[model samples]
Target: MVKRLTKHGNSLALVIDRGVLDLLEIDADTPLSMTTDGKCLIVTPVRDPERQKQFRAALEEGHRKYGKMLKRLAD
Candidate 1:
């Protein structure tokens, strides 16, 4: 599907269709990252809530196991 870029403030914005949004599992408030890979543009959701929670838990576990070493290094 093709979407036209519409004027938003001083910039043009491409409005994504509902079907594409649903397929990508993204909502209005979803955080996104945009980058260019050579001639192509890549857009991705930043993180899923469950994945982020798991990541935080792992980070905390690492801190618990290596707290002293980390503190010593910082000093």
Candidate 2:
């Protein structure tokens, strides 16, 4: 769906829909990070660094344990 930016003071803001906010579990208090690939904007919740480290560790362990079996299954 296309959305038009709303005038906020001298700048513009994209008002997020309540349903979309609820689906993403984003509230006013939740921190968000915005980035762009020069053409499109991407908005996402800021994830915890420690949680990310834990996830990477778990993924490494899973790959170490199942890499061979998974590769065989894929082929």
lDDT of 2: 0.95
* lDDT to native, each model: 0.92, 0.95
Give the range of the ten consecutive residues with the poorest summed lDDT in model 1: 40-49
lDDT per residue (tens digit) for residues 40-62 in model 2: 99999987899999999999999
Could you say which candidate leads in TM-score? 2
CA RMSD per model (angstroms): 7.9, 1.4
Clashes of each: 0, 0
Where does candidate 1 clash, by residue pair? none
